[model samples]
Target: MASITLNKLVKRYGNGKTVNQVIHSVSAQIDDGEFVVVVGPSGCGKSTLLRMVAGLEEITGGEISIGNRVVNTLEPSERDIAMVFQNYALYPHMNVFDNMAYGLKIAKVPLVEIQARVDKAAKILELGEYMQRKPRELSGGQRQRVAMGRAIVRQPQAFLFDEPLSNLDAKLRAHTRLEIQKLHRELGITSLFVTHDQVEAMTLAQRMMVMNAGVMEQFGTPEEVYSRPATTFVASFIGSPPMNLLKNAPDARPGTIVGIRPEHLDITATGWALRVDALEMLGFERLVYGRWLHGAGNELVIVRSDETQPVPGLDTIIHVTPRADRLHTFDAATGKRL
Candidate 1:
């Protein structure tokens, strides 16, 4: 219901010269009711940033504001925010209903009000029938739903999800992703989800904040991030097979790095000749992996081929072409976009 602002946030540990600064002067404005995912690789400080916003990690410098109120010194309990952790954190002895209602019970919300909220959340989450089931009786997806339901019952200003879907299997993860999208539409709650998975970031985020080593690499729509990555890290990390970073390109300007996604490449009579080294079939499509024969094939490039296309034998030379507009250029020295 309110916009969250992180103004030059910083996090560090230890004292003086021995200090390890993990998060560095991060700033972002998350609009009200926006589902923004903070995505990055492991040790990139995505979770640490989320924790700072949730008031779980103390900000070493800068201010955090929720709905115009600065919450820098506020305790986690007083932040008026609900956090759904990766672990679900459901009490094994309690039923789903109890798990969702415990926070309200602690806050001394009216029992009728608590019941109404929990019931509404359970219904929204399609968890009505599982209300009496304990954590032990539920599957991974259901337990994750219970965690979401607990947050929903709080009806806080915003929701902070820390890899809420990490534990689910592929099918369940996909299903629950749709469930989350529906839940967000129904409730219109402001949310910040943290994940290392770019797939989740692409599917779930309205605007994604890409972080790398405590610095925000880019903040934009999924399409913008994909089509025009801000740096080599963003270019390489956002895609599935990742963008092929062509280092020391024969034709590129000095210190320039070229990047191209696998899908954008085509098997053509013209263009670069890639030395076919490997292939991986992924049902509908195949991944052709090889190096550019002319340029020393220093880094393996991947090209997605449809099932209809014939798979070539290894060691066979494959000529590849890249879509002209799909080319991404960055500085080899700083890795920043050129």
Candidate 2:
């Protein structure tokens, strides 16, 4: 395992007056054997950042160091890093064993050592039974495992994953997430993962970096970023169903937006009355959408409940309030956390 560091890294597309910056002045330190995830919306430069660390993309400014060595000028092969792509780039004609051993063979590793490495990786990925099968014969999940196995054989200093599970179905994605967590625990290698899915970032990362439009918005553990977001964008982006923003609340200061998560609201015994406009019953929980009686501008709020208590439907009044600590305050003018 190796520690990775990015020192004021910047990537620009052109020169002089035509320069288009893709990655801003971003810097981060990833410790050895840590699982770090870079997450953001589409076209936010998360994958570009990963590629920069992998030597696939050029750095217009600053340096990237892996294991105490500056590798900005090094070739991808010389960086001692392995990347697992989203598409599971495996040779359709090659069997599992050859697929896993191909990298070692190209590096001129001894045949005996290559066999040992392939066997170990296959066993770890549960691909031992499919070693003779070609990519066409295996299932999608199995093919992804083969891709992972190929990276494992190299035993690189660090692992770079660019949405490795994006191609799988929902059920398989969940199953493979557990497998990935287990694998990380077993190998304990330094890893950098990039994905747009916030749930994946929350579950897989020891620390996560949230990016927005080529700029980093927040960098912290999953709890810190979720429970105490640094901006309104993060407050809404990190949660399921998103946070409800009281854009023009009468009680809020001028240029302030009140943020409340759905799960942090309750049907209070005595509070402002909410006229229920819609109800969505999930298996384990139900969601209530309502408008505040004293509010204007068509503002809506959501409340979650697991009990089957009767709730007024289609414009019926019910008392509801937000949890004190769960209320997030953001400056409407700048969208920054208050």
Candidate 3:
């Protein structure tokens, strides 16, 4: 139950002549019991920052604290933290119960206390029925849960997860996400998760950090990041199929890019007309793609609708309209929201 703080964190490799800055001057405060996900594209340094906090990576500069203690110089074992890696890392020969109790054994916790903690964790993770099962006997999702249970039995001040669900199938990943959320609520331990999946970040985070090329793009609730993205990269990266970033003229007022989400589009009877290019009928919803009018060029604009309207033939005319708020403007030079 500790709040984590980062102050001007910096990670650089090589000397000043060729410094490869993996993390810039990063600073953030994660409240106690907060479930914060750090999300970014590959090579953006989200995992680097998480590793620094875990003491797995050295911080070139700045301060990191857990509760009121500065832990930058502490070894991973001394940080009062538990980490659940992407790989389950379970011992092949160890049974679930043994795996969960191993940490306590290493710390010389009394046998009875270890049993009580392991048993409690097993119940929480629904592993009571599989306590005797070895890693080979369990499914991928089960192994992931076992990794989580191992961390839980420690009752550490915080938990760090690095793409914990990357290996699971879609359904199992979704189920496990819910389980993790529930576990967070039950344990109330401070947690930091790192992932590239926007869906996972959106669903699992109470607050989140969006990182880009080692710099934090945004830090706020999922709603704030989604509804009011601070930059064009964030606007495009946070949503499915991403926000449409249409290029406008250099003299295009204050906004060089016009953004619109597919769901916010309207199938208007009269508006900027276009020729139907393609359609995707997805049971409950449909995506319509068409060429924009006003010499808007050969590129396509996408719109989503719930009603399976007439599937227009290729090149057939279709008009589009969008809600005013759904339309976004971004500065051309910096690609920042306007």
Candidate 4:
């Protein structure tokens, strides 16, 4: 495993005035044996960034270093990185063992060494019994595991995943996530995973880079990103229900927006009056969507109430208090944390 570094990376399509710049000057240092997730919505340049690092996309400017070597001009095979894509990309005609060992075979590795490597990968991925099975016979999760096993056999300096779990069902995705976590724990390989799912990003990442519109909005641990979002875009995008940003909030300062998470608001007898618009039951907890009564614009606010709390009726007026310490302040014009 080796460290990966992106120094002022840039990517542009077309030339002259028609040039479309997708990736801005993004830079981040990924430590050796660390798992970093690059997460964002589609067309946000997250995949583009990953492809750049994988040497699949040409860099318009700046340098990409894998370990001690600068790999800007290197071919994808020469970069010593293994990429697991969204598609399984397995050979239907070949069995799991042959699929996993194909690259090593092409590289002219000894038959004994190829068998050893494929066996080790199959054992790691729990595919020992299905080594002779074709891709058509395997389940989706198993096929994904085969794809991963193929990469593992390469034993590259780093692993790059481009939405590898997107094709699976919810349960399979969750299960595969655990398998991936276990794989990382055992191998300790440097991994850069790209995904649009926030849950995947939060759960799998040692550190996550949140990107938007080709710009990296924030880069930090999941805890840091959730607890202290640097900008309004991040504040709104990172959470489940997302942080509520109210422009016309009570006791508001000029040109500032008050941001609060649903869970941080306490339903109280006296505070900000909220007229309940809707209520969503989520097993152990309920989400109360309401409009602030006092504000001129009647901005919407959501409050999370646990099973211990009473569920409020629709159109009923309920008071909720925002925790002073938990409130986030952002500059309304710039959408940046203040």
Q: Largest lDDT belongs to which candidate?
A: 4
Each candidate: RMSD to true structure?
Answer: 1.6, 1.6, 2.0, 1.1
Q: 119-146, model 3: which lDDT tens digit per residue?
A: 9998998899999999999999999999
Residues 129-203 of candidate 4: C-alpha lDDT, one tens digit per residue: 999999999999999999999999999999999999999999999999988999999899999999999999999
Backbone collision count in every prediction? 0, 0, 0, 0
How does each model score on TM-score? Answer: 0.95, 0.95, 0.94, 0.98
lDDT of each: 0.91, 0.90, 0.89, 0.94
Better of 1 and 4 by lDDT: 4
The residue-by-residue lDDT of candidate 2 on 202-311, one tens digit each, is: 99999999998888889899999999999888888898988888875445777899988889888877775778889998878889998877747378888887766565
Off by over 4 Å in 4: none
Return the clash pairs for model 4, or none. none
Residues forming the 10-long window of minimal summed lDDT in candidate 1: 246-255
Superposition TM-score, candidate 4 onto the true structure: 0.98
TM-score of 3: 0.94
Q: Clashing residue pairs, candidate 3?
A: none
3 or 4: which has the higher TM-score? 4
Off by over 4 Å in 3: 16-18, 249-255
